[model samples]
Target: MTTVAARKALWKIPEAMELLSISRTVIYEQIRAGRLRTVKCGRTRLVPDGAIAEYVALLEREAGR
Candidate 1:
């Protein structure tokens, strides 16, 4: 059976830009630099659902204890 849910999901560049509150250029730069990972479906690209959480962990590590 199918179900309905209000789940969050991987966003396209524009939605991601809104979530992260950054510019399109900056987001594109990160994707180009491989700092952020993405998935491709046909001609569309998307960041994974876990990407932001992983990125935050990396940031924490970089900060050092």
Candidate 2:
């Protein structure tokens, strides 16, 4: 997928995992621990584009931003 589209889509959990190369367990753990923000619809969890960016920024900040 193009960066433009990737920048636009609100990723479902599997898609987010594919892009981040993170496992489902880690993702769920992050969501539950509030390190990442997520929205749930029934049994499906969706992660926001902004949340992913913010989360990455948080990691960078924690590393000494």
TM-score, every prediction: 0.73, 0.77
Cα deviation in Å at residue 23, candidate 1? 0.6
TM-score between model 2 and native: 0.77
User: For this target, which candidate reaches the highest lDDT against the unseen true structure?
Assistant: 2
Off by over 4 Å in 2: 1-6
Whole-model Cα lDDT per candidate?
0.80, 0.85
Cα displacement (Å) at residue 19, model 1: 0.9
lDDT of 1 at 42: 90
Candidate 1 structure quality by residue, lDDT tens digits, 1-65: 99898646777888888877789998889888887788998999988868866766776898996
Q: Candidate 2, residues 1-65: lDDT per residue as tens digits?
A: 65653375478988888877799999889898999998877897799888888888888899994
RMSD of 2: 3.3
**How many clashes in each candidate?**
0, 0
lDDT of 1: 0.80
- For candidate 2, the lDDT comes to 0.85
